[model samples]
Target: MFAVSGGGRGDGSWPGARWREAIALTLETSTIDNTDNLEPTPEPLHAGAPVRPDSPTFAELGVHPDIVRALNEVGIERTFAIQELTLPLALAGEDVIGQARTGTGKTLGFGVPLLQRLRPASADAENASRDVPQALVVVPTRELCVQVTRDLADAGRHLGARVTAIYGGRPYEPQVASLQRGVDIVVGTPGRLLDLAEQRHLVLGRINALVLDEADEMLDLGFLPDVERILRMLPEQRQTMLFSATMPGPIITLSRTFLTQPTHIRAEESDASAIHERTRQFVYRAHALDKVELLAKTLQADQRGLTMIFTRTKRTAQRVADDLADRGFAVGAVHGDLGQGAREQALRAFRSGKVDVLVATDVAARGIDVIDVTHVVNYQCPEDAKTYIHRIGRTGRAGKEGVAVTLVDWDDVPRWKLISDELDLGVDNPVETYSTSEHLFADLGIPAHANGTLPKAARTRVGLDAEHLEDDGRSGRDRRGAPSGRRERSGSSRSGSGRSGSVRSGSGGSSGRGEDSRGGPDVADPATDIAAPRANRPPRQRRRRRAGALVGEPATDERIGSAEAHQSPVPELAGQGETTRRPRRRRRNGGASASSQANQTVDTQDAAAS
Candidate 1:
């Protein structure tokens, strides 16, 4: 295997220059599998070449006839530049490091070869367990995992390759059962894949080929450790392929450590801008409050089909989606805050044309492959150049002409300028624009009379609700019914303990603090026997105290009849017709003797009693 790196070096460097340089130097000096002398290095494949009638076909590149037939059935007759360059080497079981911008057909660049290399289930030995997957693809996000699985399944349909997607957010039972039924290729996220592998539900011992798509994203999400752990679990003798839009330091280190004599193939020229040339990009400095209004107008642009609005936060994604939906635009949202089922539901709605607009965070920027996305609106400025490319790359896919609009708030102007400078966007200082701006109308082909709210006649597509949300059987709370109005007591009741005396039903009923609905104190009924009779009740007791000393004698129950009896000078006797006074102890340090004080107290009590 040989490495091919060709590109013009511009003044401005790529985002991760240090790592890129390191990779370039390593590729120059090292020989992959000591095969550098076996074959001459081929010419570099430039991405500038679009698929035309004269371009190489999948079959010419030694692709399996069954897989080629599947692609032809779907109208995919030609290979993109990345696919054209990657297919030949990958089919030979060589470790490949594919670096290409987003939306450049990287999925099939690796997927087609992966499917071709896997043995069909029907061809497996009779004694070999069909449950062991022969090929595995690890992605960063669940949406991407699903998309890859779908694409692979479509390409491998003629070959009868069972492609299953295993990821989090849904029930594990379904995935476990899918594995048990036998799978030829597995596409999943790191966490869920590791979970099943550790639990013995997923078998990786026989995996002959592995692909790590979006390796940089895995690093950004702190999933590198988990990816490493998964790598260690796999068999040492395997064909590994790592693909990413950008290569960071850790990703470079990971590639060096894990990949053996990998061919580093870059589709584009070294100095070529990562942004797609077919996508018309526009940047505007606008007020944060006016972004939604501007977005509504942008969505109303003529020929806008399946527009996407991206925000920096999940709340903003949901807010923008809600605002657009309120304006009568069919819109759905995808973000981290949403459950896996909801995310998939929104994605399905967007793909099925049920919703023409999708509001999402950066999570959707990586693996969401929609060919008909005519426009992408950055509702909030992206953090950096790499994100901006990924965000806008959703459009202008497969040589399709598209538009990208970036709305930068005042606070994000500095951040946007950094991105612009890095990507050579040239719009460091964006023109101040608003919803009613004349230039905005002309640029996006918005009708001169268009307004912020979508007219009733134009609202034809079904909304997000029209798409059915699949029951993953995990979210019981969402399927649960409203709580009953009646309240039930579970234990025995206690009286005079500051607890609720009675259990009431319905609204505006008595409260636990003994207050009625009208805020008045609740009075017990005299005719109704809510408590036991006085004759049947036990006697109440109180300890008598003289000055500071206890008398060690109990008082009668009658003494507790009224509040004033306890405050009166005469103390009630415990027995019938009996009055007793205990002798007082002497005071340690006092002006008045304890005996004198006690005697005076008894005299005052007797006088009061008389």
Candidate 2:
């Protein structure tokens, strides 16, 4: 077995075993009240010592002149500690493992070398003629894939490098088409990239550089198997780079297996300077039912621009968005239940200031780097310290100040305690808080007379309805209403009779709560249900009413007429001759058929007369 190594803390303990034990112990101690504020707090990034004037520039760090010029044009003159340390070694084409906190410019640490190694001048003319990928960057989420792809494209604009981002929640055709046209770099999530490779749409045989971005988060998400399969497909002699926020044992094992004599580099903020020093954190004990009211009150605080609220599940995300919208807040929701189009729309609206508030699930919020996010509210307590860090990291980015507010319900007190202990966020026992609590106003700087209601003057400039989102990332066939060139043949041909039929479910019907937020096959996005428009398919179902209740639903009074219902029967149309419809019996047998009921009533009356 490979020799087990601890994270640079030099404790000499097996990192994976230690991490697992820590989680187990934290969970066990959840019910027990332990010491609070036991750990000293670190300084924020801003309070750290300034960078030296002699710090290396992109040009001094072996970056190409064109890349240097592009960086200069973008106002990025000096490199961060991680970039300065990793660039020279990376430029030398060595396997590298980079460890740093989030928002520390990890992308450029590996991305620059990945692009430099793919230069046409470095390869023969004949070899450069083929349109195939020379570099591969794997991330854990589509949001990260898009981000990495955009950054690389911007940096390589003068170099003529073509980057393609592939992920799920999109049709396969656009990706396949992009692959056919040939791309220089392939940035994608695990599952979609693997699918294209297995289907022969993506060729990885010639990749010169392989970068695994956010490797720890990838492992946490159980993408290890897919990562292994992908690594096996690449050439053995390729340069590899692994970057993660933390050095867990599993990530170390992965790096050992993948990297050939890799250089280990860790460039973290000063020990006294915490990665999250710029963010103010507030933890409050809250009642589950009253949390919404508390959230509304918080949103109404002064200078609360671009707030992001994170929930544990998609159901909560939608419910929160709906509740906020009901109160006239410009809100949008990103979750698994939304289609790719809807997800993208929500993100765009949030970014464009059309929607000031974005409610999202943990998975949906991954790799979302939105600057100017003044506050992050955890609608539900996070499951772990890493999750808590990521949720709060959304705010206080780009060297700006931010606030993170967490409302922990009684049931989640233990979980919150574990997170607080791990992160050393000194909320030993959060003060009990309600919507009307005076502490809420004083802590977050809300107006003394502020109610839980949002006023028209407080609304953002635009709402989600005003924005028009175009869904180009998805394939033509699956683009909802968009036309496509190649049509997908789902199965063997079958015909259906065109008939007018009642909906599967009536409007305002309740749905079964069995489906979780991650969305399995059974849980279809009703808004983008492509099957609805098919010629032979049955009429679209009512909003959510079950099929069985349509014709048999009981009324308060059984004999109520059209006048009592405040409606009249349909009149004969011009095209069709006069047709009269009869009122049918509600049920059969016990609730007898209409004809049987009429005959029985006459027989009973005759017997009574006799």
- TM-score, every prediction: 0.72, 0.71
Report lDDT (CA) for all predictions: 0.69, 0.68
| Total residue pair clashes for candidate 2 | 4
**Candidate 2 pairs with clashing backbones:** 43-272, 44-277, 505-545, 506-545
Could you give candidate 2's per-residue lDDT for residues 316-357 as a string of tens digits? 887787777777777777766554555566676676677788
Model 2 off-target regions past 4 Å?
A: 1-52, 270-272, 472-610
**Least accurate stretch of 10 residues (summed lDDT) in model 1?**
27-36
Query: Candidate 1: global Cα-lDDT?
Result: 0.69
User: Cα lDDT for residue 70, model 2?
Assistant: 65
